[model samples]
Target: MPCAMAIWRVYLLPLLLLVLLRAFTSLPTQAAARGGADPSSGTDDGKHGSFSRNLLQDKPEITEEMTRGYMSNSELEIAVQDFGRRCANVSRVYSIGKSVNGSPLWVVEISDKPGKREAEPAFKFIGNVHGDEPVGREVLMQLAYWLCDNYLKDPLATLIVENTHLHILPTMNPDGFALRRRGNANNIDLNRDFPDQFFPINDDINYRQPETRAIMSWIKQEHFTASAALHGGALVANYPWDGSRDKRKQYYGCPDDKAFRYMASVYSQSHYNMSLSKEFRGGITNGALWYPIYGGMQDWNYIHGGCFELTLEISDVKWPKASELLVIWKQNKMSMLNLVASLVKTGVHGRIFAADTGRPIPGSLMVKGIDSKISASRTFGDYHRILAPGESYEVVASMEGFTPKRTRIMLERESMNLDFILDPDGAAGQTKRLPRDDCGCSCDDDGKPFLIREAYLWLYLLVVFFLLVLYLLFRRRISSRLARNPPKRPVAV
Candidate 1:
């Protein structure tokens, strides 16, 4: 009986414990893969994620066709291609990746020189994150078409087309749209699918949906000064930190809280009625303050891509009548244009170069008080920093091997272009090494390796436990042998 019990304790106990641990950890993974929370309960948008989708969904099926008069996936592609052909000199169409359902994630680069690199800031707009909230997709297409039609004719459009590279991804979740659900074909919410600053959910890149991965890859390749994602269900501009550290719902702001607030307010104040919202008090709420959601895209963009992103809930209704999309586009047009134009119209735009060789140096821009830093372009050493129109800011440009340069610029309502030629930190020609973003510890993704190290501690603990089990098993066998034979009393020595 003791032998049976020992065998069970030595082998079955560890196996059982292992099984329990795996089951414990897999709960959130399973939940996330299945769309994290129930969309029917309005958990996707919380107070601001979705609008009265329940009431909309309650309508008769006969009205479905009328409500969905928005462009089909194929129709949108045709529109994109037609615009590309018509505006070939100013625009180009390209695909970032494919959806789980094999629909292309198309992007329209609207610029004077669409595919070329210039000393200009890049801005991206991602729409149709949720399949049910199709307002963003239609509005984005309208935005693209409007830009294509008005470029060289409209001053604002001409400024954007000539000075900045605007990348418009009309629909990010075609699979979700095709399925008419909040999540993708895998039923995963793409917005809640990023690696969270608080929770380590979706840390592994593989588990991220194809659409999510495509956006991640795109941002990594492009240095966007700022960007915004379009959403429906609520009329507000949402900024991060999306999740609080204590997992509580409250106003949790990141390092550049004021800048984010300003960015969000830019959208809300520019909108037709967003700034008049009674609930959000300016139609802009800190994401976590609205409701804590882990693994959101806005926070990830700010943290990893070094881009300022606003999650704009542009409509109070998730799926309004197709006729309302033009109104929606009109409402958001100025906000969108002004937001992108702010990159080139205001703030400080500059290039950093080596003082000795007169060569461009890929440096980073940082305001003395602001905690965040923006890396300069590798090709042109160009950097664009967006600040409120009227302010006196002491901006600093830094490179790894160079002595950082500081310039006090009193930026008025117009843009300031300040170039820096940094001297070597020590010797005239020698350089000091600085950290790279691709290092195992990247500042792009929150400079903390604390989470990964904490996760590794579990493997270390498991290894220690396995060693303890082996040691105990050996002792138990020795004890049983000694009990059985008494060890011959050491031959009476």
Candidate 2:
């Protein structure tokens, strides 16, 4: 009996060792499957390290008449051509240049009124500046398809295409995209390659790549009103000019600083779940250079071209899976439409004052003509509002001391300028009010004030609560596991 028990123990010990070995060996594969780190590469164990694998293995094939989340260089080319063919009335494809590897750099222009392209202000969207950050390319491609397909059905889409010229270069670095490398075929970072008239290029970074030169030339010729370059690895919309550092060599603010703030705020409000007015409190950091980067696309666009350019880092993960593309598309599509549509027409500026006291009244003013919307201006004297063109509309100004002023105006033309002065009795009196309809006339759809969307606010709160609950559950599980398997003690000192 003793001999048989010994034999059983010996066999069981080897079986247990074999099972442990298999489990240890499978850890890397399991991690990769969960979108985690690659054990083979001794790098940081996170989304960044395994981004390429996720991109390559998970993306689906592109198809015509249907939107796809993932695509390769050749697949994307075919998809773009198909989109052009399907939406021949509203879209056109143009070749900007060729990559170093002889791949064509394609731009898909989407506009409802194709013949009226030259007359309108163009807004360019480029993606995949870093080869590994492919989410932008997918998102832009999806947007192009959406804009072209839904032109007649969707009011916002129709409005944008009818008013503005949207130029989308889905892949800026085809060679790098093909190779899945951060740098182009020539091993140059395209974002840093723009011509710096003041700061000359040096060996620390190479800024004279062919792709960058082509982009600069295009910008000079196109005179785009606003542009956005999309990237990944960080989830924030960064704006220019990004080359400045403060007295401590810490990343600081850009020049033309106010414009940067305005544009960044616009982007955050339109897309991310954060306040546009504040910086870095929620959502993502804005304006301030929290990271050190030089010769980026946004800085070049703002400084040289005098255009409002933004760099939208779409996801915290380096290369998000094809499945995650749709979520990103939903978040960015409206913002993209808003940015382009806002540029088609300009804003109207005016001042409000008390008719009785002849003093400026500061308060909230609502402009409802082309579009029913409200805008607030510095109440002390001047107020500026932006609205679209149509015909009959009303402008109402309200304050505590002054009676709410309401006036009717007709904007038959494309742009109109008008002014107003409010009487104590909420009537338009005989005072030469500044033109309220000045500047270019365009509709302002800033959406319901943050308070009115109570349902959305509650939904957001619920999501936060759920996430907190999940975190606590995960923390407890980890704690219990640690307690059950405490670390083994070392030998006596």
Candidate 3:
């Protein structure tokens, strides 16, 4: 009996260990074979094609059966135009540009004063970056409709419409959506089409895809305070420095890292199940920390457009059933609203104007210690500087001709209004008045011009005296010069 027991322990345990190892190793192959999501994937450029990790495993490949009830491109266009007509008072529909297949990239600008530049922060939502990810496009359309239907009736909706210019691009890549693929008509990933900070893939202007060009142009035309591009196949809010400097997959954070983390948290904490995610802690991640991808839209918006942007992976499934879209919207509703409201509810918003002229000046805004700078709009001089609350900051506003003003504020939980009326650096110096109103709310009143008048009087007198002295000197010098060297007489007529 003792001999039999020893033999059983050795043989059975060894067999079991071998079988377990084989089963664990076969999991990926089994997943691939079942047409289920496998982490293995390749890029449109055909690089990194099979290095998908467990975290990146997607839903089974999208099929026609899955997209049966989804809106077609023609139907989407009609819907957008219809939305414009129904909500014309708070919305305007316009085309940013066309897709590769010449499908108009329709944008719904929602604001109390649509198509006008007011002293307000602008936010944009771009959906359908990937052709296969139809969830974002549908959900974004739902967002627009909700805002239209709830405006004035809902407090949050009313706040957004009256105080913010919200731009909704329901689909950025219609050709990709129609094809039901991961890329555009030319098969280029629109997300990777932007010029990367570390790579030269899209440096040449002419070489960019039409969809990428349109977005680049649109950002240039509008001074968006913040923007987000919606995506799926994951559920997390991603923030910038999408790639590391060394081209390694590591946590590469941008200058506004803290502020971005706060913004991302605002979305995750507001969501129903996002904060409960077991994969990503707190449902937020730095772009490079997740997986280093260059030429991404989020990083470009932050770096070039002065727009603080987030890449939102709002769904775990890339192509969810059409019926599931409404539920998805309901889950992400508060997140979307809170994110837009952050522009007005948590930021330092104000206009920069010339004190003497009272005209809006296109100025750049910078926090005292932070390296990054956001610019005010050229039309309205309005700038929105979103920051984490409960901290003191020295907000600096500067224009080329105006004296840069720096004022410190103890920002509480709510947003603070800090309008800066900068005097011309030249004017302040010429007047020599009281260190140029370098402190709090001094420009609120031009009530007393007496000091300016006194300074001007002295300046005028000094200029006149100098000019009279110069004239006498010139007379004396001319008389002496004529004695030394006679002036040439008119010789030829």
Candidate 4:
């Protein structure tokens, strides 16, 4: 009996040991199957021990069907290409530059008229400077498709494409997009990389990667008149003159300052519920490094490039669901159209000042000569008239207690630093003032007073005429001088 019991213990003990070893070996695999142990994960530290239990109890399954509704980077590219192919007349896909990962940086040029590219002012719509904020790209693609499909049927669409060139670069950071990250492949924030007046190169938190360089190069080459960069994680429309800590910063009211305010006001009226006057609040004040940013794209666009650029923070939450796309599309579509449309027609922009004091005059009317469109100066005494380019027109200013002053001008070139002053009507109680023609010279038989004609044209002709006459006179003088004083000839070569 003792020998039989010893035989049973040896066999059973070996089997028990083998079973225990197998169970111990499978523990790590089971832990990994439950999402593994990530020390840096936002979950609690002690939770690692119960990972397997929690995962089995609370894990949510992500089915393939759910993912089919949303777009990946590759899928988006294919869709863009297909859309371009369908609307061959109005849309064309071109490469802006190559991404760090060797993918072509795509730009879709959308216009209704095929042959009028150069004759139009271009409005650039860019998206996804931060790879994680991909909604902008989707919105841009939708805009392109809507414009192309509705060009013939929609009057506004036809007018916009015919008059303005729409350049859309859907994804600026393709590499970061592929990785589903905010920073690019090199871990650089493209927004903070722009070469601003503050920083020309990457320093501290500012890092310019290849993607930003490509964008800067494209902007320089294209010379876009107006543009907007789309961002996510905030629900507001941000405009330029952003470099100062406060809205009252000195640079905010500089020479081109009126232009910045006009841009901000236009964008606010079009899209978001916020006002340009109150956009700077909380910690995220205007464009200043008050938030510790070294360089930013919007500031660079305004200061360095002379193009009016704004940052449109389109969503209140990050990674917005697919359903929110259409809502955003509807909200921004008209505002975007209006911004581009305003650049067309004719524009009158000048400074108004007090006739007596030579100080800025606020709330004055600036009427376009050709279209007779009126724009009013803001409290800061700056005004801009949006009209058809390459058209000649006059601007008139009228204020209370001052004589009306008018200036004939041309909108062929971008005008700058135009200042005006109104004069008082005669002395204290003269009642009747001298006519404007008296000071300017005489009026024609048609009663039209001409202050100045195309003096440059006449001056150019006069210079050429004078030079030709002088050439002839100089030739005769030289011949006469030679007859009077002949030069001595050399004896030999």
- Supply the global lDDT for candidate 2: 0.60
Which residue runs of candidate 2 sit more than 4 Å off their true CA positions? 1-69, 115-118, 202-207, 245-255, 272-279, 282-288, 345-493
Q: Find the candidate with the highest lDDT and give its number.
A: 3
**TM-score winner:** 3
- Model 4 sits at a Cα RMSD from the real structure of 33.4
Error of 3 at 434 (Å): 24
Per-candidate TM-score against the hidden true structure:
0.75, 0.55, 0.76, 0.55
Candidate 3 residue runs with Cα over 4 Å from true position: 1-60, 427-493
Count of backbone collisions in candidate 3: 3
Error of 2 at 81 (Å): 0.8
Query: Could you tell me the TM-score of candidate 4?
Result: 0.55
Clashes of each: 3, 15, 3, 10
Better of 2 and 4 by lDDT: 2
Q: What are the Cα lDDT values of the candidates?
A: 0.78, 0.60, 0.80, 0.59
Residue pairs that clash (backbone atoms under 3 angstroms), model 1: 45-49, 50-233, 51-233
Model 4: residue 212 alpha-carbon error in angstroms: 1.2
Range of the 10 consecutive residues with the lowest summed lDDT in candidate 3: 40-49
RMSD of candidate 1 to the true fold?
A: 16.4
